[model samples]
Target: PKRKTVEKHGRDLRDIIGQQQGKRALEIAAAGNHNLLFLGPPGTGKTMLASRLCDLLPEMSDEEAMETASVASLTQSEINEHNWKSRPFRSPHHSSSMAALVGGGSVPRPGEISLAHNGLLFLDEMPELDRKVLDSLREPLESGEIIISRAQGKTRFPARFQLVGALNPSPTGYYEGNQARTNPQAILRYLGRLSGPLLDRFD
Candidate 1:
């Protein structure tokens, strides 16, 4: 038997997740059409909160659902038959590449970012990814769509997403008091990974 469609009264994710700041950020992502970066230490429940955004959000429009669904199809992800129930949430590893994050391959495919189009791109361990690959995000982050210019012509895919990135403060991931040795140079270098121009684009 087919499942029934039930009316959901938009239970605020904040009520569910309970992180005031993170919930506020999600609200902005839902309202102003902005992307966000959640900077904090590990085990902060960033992932779980990011996931619930789909549930609290208003349902996706049909055109939106289809475009959103197409992006999901590129991946091996067997989208929930109810994929159209809400917006998508795609989380990729830090090892993801420019092509993998942006969308490319021999056969030409949608990458994680593309898959997150009209939804959310939750990037865990933001700094560990190749600087070049991470830099590539600057474009889609601004354009909301990627133009895959190839010899066969150009193919554009929607990439309008709320980018939520999380990264450790340092390689060792810790803070050191006065007596402890903390590398200021390393901190500068790590932060330098996200170039000035790229950083300027994000909210």
Candidate 2:
């Protein structure tokens, strides 16, 4: 497919104010393809920071572009020529199912992680997701690909994408401060929804 020239526009890191640590972390993640997690209160620009990480990423190589486009073509009707060479940025909602996050069905279609191949996967409100759904990502995060097996057959999809996650420190979106509404025990349980192994995957 002939690639079209498209003007890329996105949130600039420069426009965000007063998050030196977050900005630095984004730079490091972009440079090394590291998985990242942002923990803070609500309305702290965690999602904003995650969204802009893609802008900092370098252009996809031809091979990478083809790999990413191929996965997208499976789910989308057509790949936009102007964005064919661009890296994918998939942000599945916190309530996504295991199949939705990883990939599954009677026919085994690619999921958000697969579609984000060679690009980025942003998970906002990370701890709010079902534990099972989040843990399903463990293998792919380490192996750079996912294998879907069904009674009829098995299929594999590439999933080598950087993961960026954001979440509040507590259920009420506050923690260990004067305005905190949730108790320490409840807060621990809320954050505990993310298993140790899953949390270990992030830098």
Candidate No. with top lDDT: 2
lDDT of 2 by residue, 1-203 (tens): 99976577667698999999999999999998899999999888899999899989888889998888888889883665866776778899888998899999888999999998998999999988998888899999999999999888789999999999998998888866777878889988999999999889998
lDDT of 1 by residue, 97-158 (tens): 78888988766788888888777788877778888888888888888888888888888888
Per-candidate TM-score against the hidden true structure: 0.83, 0.93
Task: Mark the 10 consecutive residues where model 1 has the least summed lDDT.
Answer: 173-182
lDDT of 2: 0.89
The lowest-lDDT stretch of 10 consecutive residues in candidate 2 is 77-86
Residue 180, candidate 2: alpha-carbon lDDT: 84
Model-by-model lDDT, in order? 0.74, 0.89
The positional error of residue 118 in candidate 1, measured at the CA in angstroms, is: 1.1
